[model samples]
Target: MHVTDACGRGGATPPSRWDPAEPDPVAGLLATARRRLGMDLCWFSRLIGGAQVIEACDGDAAAFGVHPGSTVHHPGPHRSHALAERPLPVVGRIRPEAVTSGTATEATGTAATGVEATGGPLAGRPEVGSYIGVPVTLADGRPYGMLCCLSRDADVAMPARKTRSLALLAEVLSASISDRRSGGEYREAAWWRIWRLIDSGGPTMVFQPVFDLPSLDCVGAEALARFPPGSGGAERWFADAAAVGLGPALELSAIRSALRAFTCLPPEFGLGVNASPATILSGRLADAIADIPADRLVVEVTEGDRVEDYPSVRCALGVLRREGVRIAVDDVGAGYASLHHLVQLQPDFIKMDQCLTRRIDADPARRALAAALVHFAQETGSLVLAEGVETARELGVLIGTGVHQAQGHYLAPPGPLPLPASANRTRPPDTA
Candidate 1:
């Protein structure tokens, strides 16, 4: 059966109505919830024709016939159906007799419903011993579906805090669904394309040289994520991923892909990877670069999301620093926060943003600001790197300002491979 859109307009399509073979973001959320919550199974179902139809599921739910595209009839008073009718979360233990005998009669007494129950699919399942669920609702307060988990252990219990956590997960699912519908066909199509790109490992890794300005020698190469030839620019692709709540996942994937090129890079050059503060705090970054020599890796924190807990972030970075991993703050001089981050983190390197680097030769104010940053970095013992040197004049001004390192189209563009060692010292003309 086709799922109706939240708008109740016949033309709007629901997530459930999409092709079953397509990847459902809700499925990923359900799987994550199940693993995080240590539940036997988790599934998302929508109410259709007085029954619950499983649209996405994870774990062992499929063993009991709770698979995607499967329909389970839950008459008027079944606990699962009753939970879906409300807008709040519900959690309760299933009686042992319900699973032992595959009967609803004994379990009905413990159910959170005020109405009597007729036998339903959930009642016949001899595996589910407890249930916790949150109603998925639309922006207009209408119920869209339910995100629920079931466990086979009768003694299983969920804390009050866990209920709230489940509610938040449900809200994320609701928002993702709403985005798909509200974004119209173009956005929905774009989401699918990006989803495929990520799933197929569509991004290719390229390295651009970062040069030490005074010595005119390449000291490092920043790993940049490049999509397929016709897949559009990197910025647009990343923006779309962020819009769909897949930003961190994609960034992590890119980092992992970039690391594969470590062996190909020259031993003297540090491998730089761009990551947001959120990704840095996740601790997964540590694992991604763990095998490589820590001193050869530079974690350049990109200015994407704001850091909420500076102390926690500092502690995480400290652990990596102890292992010889260095940190670099990207896009400095672009905003006040970047300067604040410089002081708080005391990174090993500070990268000047392109906004300040572009046309630095013509702008005295920018030159002064760059010089000041250079002096600050000098005093703090942090090396300053000027980014986006597109012209000879910009490079000359950056060099005059005592910027230790610089990189841009003027030096080299990202390529499938790093420039050979012989070409590292001489400044290459703008290739683009």
Candidate 2:
């Protein structure tokens, strides 16, 4: 996808794949994200749609890591109305924190005058007096983008306009984030805002239905986190934590939240929690590891974030695994490292990324990856859990592949905990 530079200028040339005038494909991709979270919802907003990558903050955004041909989209007073329909207004890119804080509904100006984000684009535009916008989030708790409204010479936030309308619009904004993952780009900003809430501990947990192939019954859960509006948001929670090198702290806190949230859950239910390599590889994780009840943990390792050394990470993982902690190489096939890691660390679990899991029924390549992952996990004595299962056909393929468990919307959205258990239930003890 495209990322805007700090100056709001796209530079000498625009992105090859992106036409700022037509971000629908990107928007459509974003709309497809289905967040079934227990805490505040995890956004896949277009930010999640195509999603944003934190550049190293070197050179232009493209050098940082923006996708090919993608340039940032600007929403000015002239372009403000466009947001009414599209919602997520991509700006020239900035720091991840700026993305989060900017997307939240912090009014730019007080009602002293009738304006939304005062001194904003609309302010300079003729007859513009008000503005409004919401941030989007990604599945991993990053800002996606935003949707907003503006009223020329009118108070957009005026209390007299049947405040409930604003309430309805807020609800609409909320729903849009959930809906956008499937096809809307506008929700990207909202998704980010949601993350900021989670980062702040506003988001809680939900356990979703995960199935076991042998039993053909529900077994474990994907530990999903959610955030509510007015919360600190995932950005502040995770990004700031990252900036200060406290990812492990946030992760530990999230695990505690899950423990409290899932305490009543049956022993058979396992919760999948997101983790970063930095958190995993950090020497300090011993204490964090000690805090997690060994029985309840199903750590999913997402590679999208930083991980300096693989061998050391594997050793750290070994330490946890030795303690009866079940380990998972999450999002395999979604990035570059899993295979090397799979060979080096040989985790107790392998969560095939949804990109590979999505069309397995129709695509042979996906099926092969599923099969290979299953074989690798089996050889390593690790369980295979395919994440983001969205289709019955995909489920059937997973079963055919001999995966130990499955998670995704095909069964149900990630939501509140304590799903019922049966003989086929996920074996928490088995994880160790």
Best by lDDT: 1
TM-score of each: 0.58, 0.49
Which candidate tops TM-score?
A: 1
Which pairs clash (backbone N, Cα, C closer than 3 Å) in model 1? none
- Each candidate: what lDDT? 0.73, 0.51
Q: Tens digit of lDDT per residue, candidate 1, span 293-327?
A: 88888988877767778998899898889889999
Model 1 clash number: 0
* Poorest 10 consecutive residues by lDDT, candidate 2: 33-42
Q: What's the lDDT of the predicted structure labeled candidate 1?
A: 0.73
- Report the C-alpha lDDT of model 2 over 30-104, residue by residue, as the tens digit: 222211111111122133232222211111222222233222233343134333433332212112223233231
